[model samples]
Target: MGTEKKEIVGMIRGCIKTVTCGQKLDLNHKSQNDVVKPLYTKLAYVLGLRVSPFHRRQGIGFKLVKMMEEWFRQNGAEYSYIATENDNQASVNLFTGKCGYSEFRTPSILVNPVYAHRVNVSRRVTVIKLEPVDAETLYRIRFSTTEFFPRDIDSVLNNKLSLGTFVAVPRGSCYGSGSGSWPGSAKFLEYPPESWAVLSVWNCKDSFLLEVRGASRLRRVVAKTTRVVDKTLPFLKLPSIPSVFEPFGLHFMYGIGGEGPRAVKMVKSLCAHAHNLAKAGGCGVVAAEVAGEDPLRRGIPHWKVLSCDEDLWCIKRLGDDYSDGVVGDWTKSPPGVSIFVDPREF
Candidate 1:
């Protein structure tokens, strides 16, 4: 009876990795030819390992990890990987030491709280929802060379969970429309505006619920008080509803790229548009991941309290014959300017 607790003790989860074409990924931050040669390989991601406190030291966690790896192997995965906070030494040691893995990409997590008050979409910025075809065209035309870009981009865009890709351009570029809505995305793309940015939104809330644990009592109280004061005194105007300490949903922004001097401003407007979408859907926060040195980092909305600067991702090759050829030993590659966070992966 003392051998185990009356609860689920250990667990681990795995998902297919983001697929890539055979050609080399260009990290130069320059646009590339739209042609992509298809190549198929099995790469999977493993994460969300947990073991009950009372069941520690019994090797339950190790067993779970091993089982997941075997499942990946059975599914024809050539490589498997995992991720954790850079500062989480326990996770690092467990993955890199006990398990056979090596240090990989170090991407930053940017999270911005959704304010109860709607963000004002700039009048000068006209954000239009691009049809799926147009969005894919834009991505291929501009960001096909981005690192870690998903090979099945069309499927991701068509996924119901995706709200839709959006484009932000100068309002002056929108001709003959008072509401500033442009439906003919194809024609518009043919003769594009002077400046523009494109991004897509995915509803992450449908995947799982998130809660903040291990916070000071004072912090919780202060957060609760703010929410209450806002509700009790509407005129006072509160920042956001519901403390993140409680279970909350999230909206993820991806494929953020643009051109021209006003690119950054367009990104901000899209962020505002994203925030509004998140708030309407009852999501408490918006999150995005990009290279640590991305120039666009200064433009995206994010809060320090809910963000992680150096998120560590680790990987391991399951077999020796697995050829990375054009991809190279990504574990050895330097961080690039932009990293495409596939909506399907998030």
Candidate 2:
């Protein structure tokens, strides 16, 4: 966990002070997105804040966030997000409570095998494991059809801190419908042994969307791919069927955009598909991290409340020399955020 340090500064009563920002960077060992794209560059998602209690209530927190916003903006960040627990009153108050940041979506950081039996077996969708080359087309389709987090595809692809990357394609489509499939398949990039983080990027259908209006040619392509993965990786756990309010599930992580009628439906279908994989594999859970201000939260209030844990939302200025400041105790091992999906499956 090498600390990638950045700086953030604040003004209190007209006096300037600085804070240190750091994050642990790694590759998503299970990422499904990296199968097709070449690596580029990306910033780390973790940011820490160290502020003094004596300086509390001086609007320093707001200043810190503003500074970080400016830094990301200047660095070509399309959008940046932070995570925190639902019950941490201070953190909750600071972000949505006081900082005026809106709630995005609620996602569970679920643990697997804890409640494997609770998973409903009837809601399975097919998932296909795609060769890196075939998966790239799905990646392009995901990019063209939706607005993804981190905004830039290159940055998301290039980031060192990711899990495994994988892609889901339709069962029979030679190519996606949006663009005719290109010749030549992508090969999986080999990583060094002992890599803890795996990046898995998947080109999946908006299952929830398909159930509503009807599946498109492109959607069918993704569905087919998902079917294949489900058959191959029986060890992964899946999310449950979504209701009207909780109409979406963890599948939104591969959503085209944050939220829409189509996006919601796509996510729903994805949940069904993932569930099938878990059942076949006998896996227990899945996890998803959602921004506090994500629009997807409009329907699922429980997810919003549960996702908040002990994680603090901290910000600092760039290029300011400073030591690490502490906002809240991160060492206490606050209540673990409960992810609805099994970790083993991811």
Per-residue lDDT of model 2, residues 309-341, tens digit only:
233333222332213223232212222222111
Consecutive 10-residue window with the lowest summed lDDT within model 1: 20-29
Q: Please give, for residues 86-124, the per-residue lDDT of candidate 1 as tens digits.
A: 998978988898888898778889999887667888899
Which residue ranges in model 2 land beyond 4 Å of their true spot? 1-46, 50-60, 73-81, 96-100, 104-111, 114-127, 131-134, 149-151, 154-285, 289-346
Candidate 1 TM-score over all chains jointly: 0.82
List lDDT for all candidates, in order. Answer: 0.78, 0.34
Instruction: Provide TM-scores for the models.
Output: 0.82, 0.35
Instruction: Give the best candidate by TM-score.
Output: 1
Cα-lDDT of candidate 2: 0.34
Best by the lDDT measure: 1
